[model samples]
Target chain A: MTDVEPLAVTPALEAHALSLVREGSRVLDDVSFTVAPGEIYALLGGNGAGKSTTLLTFLGFLSPSGGSVQVNGREVGADVAAARGAIAYLPEAATLYGHLDAYENLAYFLDLAGRRVDRAALEAALDQVALPPEARGRRMQTYSKGMRQKTAIALALLRDTPILLLDEPTSGLDPVAIDEFHAMVKALAAAGRTVLMVTHDVYGACQVADRVGLLRGGRLVGSFEAGPQGRIDTETVHAAFAARGAS
Target chain B: MSLVFRIAREEWRLWSRSRVVVIAALTIAVLVGVTSLLTARGVADQAANRTARQAEAEAAFFAQPDRHPHRMVHYGHYAFRTPPPLAVFDPGVDAVTGQSIFLEGHRQNTAMFADARSGADLGGFAALTPASLYQLLVPLLLIVLGHGIVLRERESGTLAVHLAQGQSGLTLMLGKALALAGVGGLLLLPVAALALAAIAGGEAPLAAVLLVGGYALYLAVWALFVLAVSLWLDRRSVALGMLVFAWLVTSLVVPRIAIDAASAAVEAPGKIESDLAMLSRQRAIGDGHNAADPAFEALRKQVLDQYGKQDVAQLPINWRGVVADYSEKKLTALMNEIAEDRMTREAAQSRVVTAFGIVSPALALGAASRALAGTDLATHHRFLRESEVLRYDFVQALNNLHARALTYADDAARSSDPEAEARTRVSAKAWSLLASFRFVPDPASARAARAVQPLGLLVFWLAVLCCAVVVGARRLRP
Candidate 1:
């Protein structure tokens, strides 16, 4: 049951009027979005802003009250296994199996996704993630935040899925690890993979994301598109974020 | 399948490092070895002692001086039933049932000197046999080892990673189940080795195989049950609580309730009532010793008419011997009817216990284990039945001796004349003609056949729990 092979030529991600209610409160209200191939879409929001809910709905972890979430162009929750197969997710905590070493955890998770890997492949993934060879055989309990994140991204690379979802991937990372993560994120986008990073780090989003959107009160209040622009207009970005709804 | 094994391999490595798991496996292994050795030795001692006692009783009976046939009938014989070679693994109902029985003419006796009559602690706290260890403690160990397979994953957030990687809930549950079953199999290796040794030493091979297979099936069931609860529950403590509760209800509470329910469902008449029924039937057949009684007087006239004799002196066969033979035949038939009725009621009671196997596989395992070991109630019933048949045969042989060896003129005057008394006494060789009571245990095929129903019930439980685990696993989310 764990082995879900992908359908060829599926889109990265798509959502249509996704409405969600939790505990009798409208969390995500008719929110619709898409992440194109080779694009990094940063979703920004305040607390109680339905940012996590939208991510969960997209992953098929939460059933939408009204509307649909699609990953790899397949309807979410309709065929959750297939949908999950088309995407790689890196949680905020990036908790790997504590009892298992990095290499064992990688092989197990990859095998679960129906991917066969040899020792060389496993070593390559760890090397790509910049995890020290010594750490590959050590228990994950001894790992730092940056190392786990690297391993997670390395797993996502092994997954080879076109879409990646990062839930505050840099939340607890140090400044140097954050820079390293941003570089990895930019590299993944450059390699033509769609990445949707759900975060509250406004400055980090402006720095790395091809486009940034402010989500508040169950809606995408504003969209700020940017290129390798001169400099981010912090005042203007803040003003747009401060606007509540229907602007 | 490969992915499931991969997951299992990882868990096994973890278990190896887990002090709690290693300690538990070692403890259960020790218990199994100790219990098997002690129980086997105890049962062997019991069989040897019973055989020796039976031999002595047979010698005493055959050594009796020449005596009148009727007097010899009252002396009776004792029959001792030996435990089957596989009794060490299960002991079954042997501890609670008496191994020796006293057989006599015109009367049937229940097997006495049962261990239960003395105390329940004969083998310590519920007769701690190998079967009990498999039924009670192994499941407890399984629960301790695996009740957190899924919950720990969910709590530590590995389940999210797995799910995000496209791993279905069913696959995860099955992998955990396989891992738990592997541990159980490892722990049970000693008992399996002992069973094979028993088979090599002349125990029924089929029965031993079934014993091993049945215990494996029983343990698999617990593994699936653990996975079912682990998937359904969110908290490790809660899952462990529910699994332990299930163990208690199925293994301990249900067996006792099954017995009480069976006794209530079937009304087996007590010994006193059955005795009264046999006595009434005896009275109806008339007294053989009283010639003045109307029933005997009518019989005497009929015999006289048949022989065309106006008196006892005219008949060629001794009329007293004829009366004894006639009374013995009628009384044996009446006693058989009572015995058959009692056996039927007991069968009905045991059936009730078997029917309860649907909700409780523990009871089913016990029943199958007993059946394979040849120590169940069915085996006990055979012992009693065979003893009665032998008793009737020997008694009838003696009655025939009385009719043929004694002349009517000499037999009737035996009490009045010393010469008649010496002539009426039969040769001592007549006692040797009777065979000793030999219990023929049913073949392994028959016992294994009887165990099929309970084994099927165990399979059904595993199948159902497996389904539950799959269903519960499918819904796993972060």
Candidate 2:
């Protein structure tokens, strides 16, 4: 009798043995990672450790030199539009058009992602992101960083893409805003969207991530699985960071 | 809502917020309005003056007293060029070129009385016509509206979010281009209204429609160029500076270079030199007024032989008048040769300038505008050629009267005998028989056909810029 391996389910996103080079400098060395659906994966790394490079590689801007990145079982480079349809991104400093109102910002971004939403839906998404009702029609220039981050999250909410790739999602937020962002991110993971966030703050990563990975020199050198409390132990993540720093 | 329209709306919102852009566009509109009004008034006044002078010339021609037909031939006629209807908007070449020409027997005259001689600040380039407004100011305003179109997103880090959200680089580029095109369309509306009003008011050619359309495409080309540079450049200030440099090169530097190239490629001699050459060539032929010039000896023999007479007195017709007619024919032919050569040289120069449209679309658009308005060098050449035709017909008709209406004895004896000179005078009714001058501009199809090349160049520029935008989009990176 022939033995065959049992197939479980395709990951929401999978980057297997990915390698990337920029301007003759190797930026990402053989990196393998996967984020299952409904899970929030946090990547902790220092500057120049290829944290953003991995995200960009998944975004199809930087082609992987060694392996592949797949979202919803479709390869990143094979059909970028198809793979892109399933992901929403919020950068470190999430930027909304300063000249556009929050409503317009949401509408424009949602439309770009092929999700047509009316004003009511847009306002609903803003509310979902805990944005104030009064800020919906005012230009984004008047909004604070937290409000801008809310607007960006609201775009992700409006786009309804299944995969969310966020870079420094909770950076530059006040303590209260940081707690609120953590709660909102937890709520997003509970609602069945896969979240992959890259950040320097280990506590923020431990607070919301179902699983955590430490990226150093573009490789996933260490990982921590979430406890029943839905948090990776900060002490273990810190030890990993310290060990990598010492070496 | 269509995606492109939404993009355009976003652009409009952004522009509305930019106080500088709003003020600049409004100022351009107001200036265009003022320029249109001034151009209309100026065109009307010039047209009226030309009409009046033409009437005076015609009245003076027929008011001649009884005189020898040959004497009336030397009286000559004057032709005045009429401004076309579209000239009220474009006023192309009218201020610099002469508007009146003199046509006399034996010698062709240069057009004289240009408006520049009055020195009313033509050199300032503040004439404020619709043509100058589009050619000079509208593109600047477009740059103000569009230079930050893409760079702003890049600088603010929104472009990465956009690209990561499945918005292809091509889509953003297209959206920004649509936005800039919308602004350009908005700016073009007022000038288009002015042109449309002129066309509807009567006496305007269908070619004026081409003028309006040409300006639209011209502005679109500007939009495309602005968007392409914005896509490629990394900073707003750098994009703006580069776009302004491009505008200066296309609108000012390239045109000047094209003019220099044209001047070098073709020799349009100075007025004095041209006149001297014509005089020299005319002298090489016999003087038309000298009845006994050796050049007319063969003509005299032909006339005498045709009449079957051995002596001048035995001929039925006047030998002196016949020699005068023969000399006029020889001189007219020589004048035609000289005039054709000058026009050919001038046309070659214009062609050289027009060919430079490959480098700068402003040259193409300016040439198209002037051609559509009937105020180009070609139009002026046509006027001259037609006026010369009229001159030849009238002069030859009077010369025919000289050969037919009087006797040879009377014509020759009139120089020595007073009664014979009195008898040699033909009736004034003969002067009335001379035809009036009329300038016929080329047909619409003909002029529009010639305009096809420049128009194609504009399209070519647009296509190339579009391709550049696409190429820029493919490698769109912050």
Candidate 3:
């Protein structure tokens, strides 16, 4: 073990051997990772790979069967609101109140995240995510999947949390929206925020992530560092994921 | 607009395509229909029994052996307010408010034998009528059908696709609410038709239309509320559990608890207390022509003074007539006061219950529907008041005959001699002069004043639910 004290320095997000058990089965087995400031880590997995479970557990929505999750070097589960306050989570296809307009949707989440954004700031956040001006006042019931996804991004931006956890963030976006989302993720990391994303798209993950980790059967099977100058092909990642799947 | 209709149609198609949903809808329709029919039948049977009993009581009163007017007052008549034709749709408080009242001279009787609260263990499980079906069961069905509208989309991974296509959660929730409202309208069709049938038959007024409108809006409120819950909870199972608990609390628990609290808050004087009070007051007032009392002596002296004669026999006006008039006025005052007090207590209880309508729309609708049906506490009070007035007139008419038709010497001698008493008894023709009791309900114009507060509360609930939908939509992330 490294002699470095886990608590001495504050990382954006750090999970030291976090484990979660459900119904006598270990869904997340001894997962350990450190997402330092300005780092983007993509969690790559197939079905039942414990990607969603790990994010949820880190949000303090689920208690770990064993191990600890920390955000800004502060322990999670012990202080749920404080831990949640530091992180913003975007579930796959985030469900919004359909009766409210986009602006109201953002406002509600901002309030929930213990931050208040004035209308101008709220509008700026929406604009940053590439949501149209006209869509702000229209009820979210009229919004498309891409527009809703943009609103979700706007919500997270309004929170201004140090860490972001996203599950299948680009799953249903159109090409343009997906590109805009990738650029937004890059910008967030550039701002010294840590991002932990779960994705199945190898190319998309390679484009946005600083390092990629493959998970199989509740365990992180492989970790690859994508250096700034180094190029990694999708075929190599697919082979590694398949080999782990076979094991 | 056509897109909305198309979406609504799609929802209908989707709902019908699910065998479970279709079966549930069918079951609700059948239950509402059967409940309507049974309640209507029950109302009709009750009306028939009341009418037959009323006619029998009248015949028996007229068929009696000739007796003194005071003795006839003690032999009271029974009058029952026949249930209205629309009461079949919503019995309202008919079961809680007694239907039959014993009307007699100098005494006010409580309306009795009409409480539905007693012995209602298992009877409450089976639907009593369409009112029960709409008030308790239909909203529950709507919740079951609509609670998964958004949650299922999210659960099955289709919600993201829908959102990606430019649809928002607000639009989805609204679409589902509109669709459920349509289903609610469908469920209401049979009952609306029944209410219309009553109006066309001349048994119900145009106010029945207002009843249908109120019920429709009330059910819509429930539909919107259910959709709101679905939007709020992340998991479909959690949404389902929460919605069911809400339905149970609103429909079953809250109203029962309110009823108990209201009853405890306002205690109504029992029938025995009222009877004894009337008896004591009557004795204190003095029985007219009974020479053993100070009140009779004062009455005799007043008659003589009014006629400017030294004795009752010497007065131009029949002294017996004067005595009968004086006695009845006193008794009438006492009975009226007692009746008024009882009515005041009952009204207080009803007001307390009505105040709870703000929390539960079911109570508001139930109260309003019953008021429109003319079967609530107010209507019961009206019937009793009218009966008392008629009883006074009937008794007084007989008293007038006893004074004018019979001589004073014969009237006084009847108490001592059986031969003179037989001679003193008024003829059957005199009995026919007394008017039959008739209950005339106030016109439609009058009912609005009584129903407006509850109707306003129902509207308030609808507005609150509309706000909830907006707030809920705003809370959705993406």
The number of clashing residue pairs in each candidate reads: 1, 0, 20
Question: What CAPRI class is candidate 2?
Answer: medium
The Cα error of candidate 2 at residue B321, in Å, is 1.9
Q: How do all the candidates rank in terms of lDDT, highest first?
A: 2, 1, 3
lDDT of 3 by residue, A12-125 (tens): 777788888989989989888878877898889988899888787776656888889887877886775577667777778776656567886676545434467799998889
**Which scores better on lDDT, 2 or 3?**
2
DockQ of each: 0.63, 0.66, 0.04
True contacts kept of each: 0.81, 0.77, 0.02
Ranking by DockQ: 2, 1, 3
Model 3 Cα lDDT, one tens digit per residue, B1-478: 4434544555676687677898988999889888787877787788888889989998998888767766676787886776666777866656655577887765666643213431121112244778778888898789878888778766755454333322344665676777988999998898788888778756646568777887897898888888777777799899889988888887777777766877788876667777887787788888765544677887777667777889777766556766776788787888788878877877787777777888878878777777776666777778878888877887787777767777777777877988888877766655665576667555655665677888899899888888888887644542
C-alpha lDDT values of all predictions:
0.80, 0.81, 0.75
TM-score of B-chain for each predicted structure, in order: 0.92, 0.93, 0.90
Worst 10 residues of 2 chain B by lDDT: B115-124
Q: Put down candidate 1 lDDT per residue, B1-478, tens digits, no spaces.
A: 9878988887898888888988998898899889988988898888889878888988898899988887888898887887777777877767876778777777888842222322211112277887788878999998998998888888887788888888777777768887998887886786688678778767888888888899899999888888788888879999988988988898777777877787678877777788887787789898766544566777788889998999877788888778877788888888888888877877777777877889888888877887887877788888888888888888888888887788877888889998998899998889986786668678999999889998999999988987888778777787
lDDT of 2 by residue, B89-173 (tens): 7776667666777777887886522123111112113466778888888999988888888888889998887787676788778
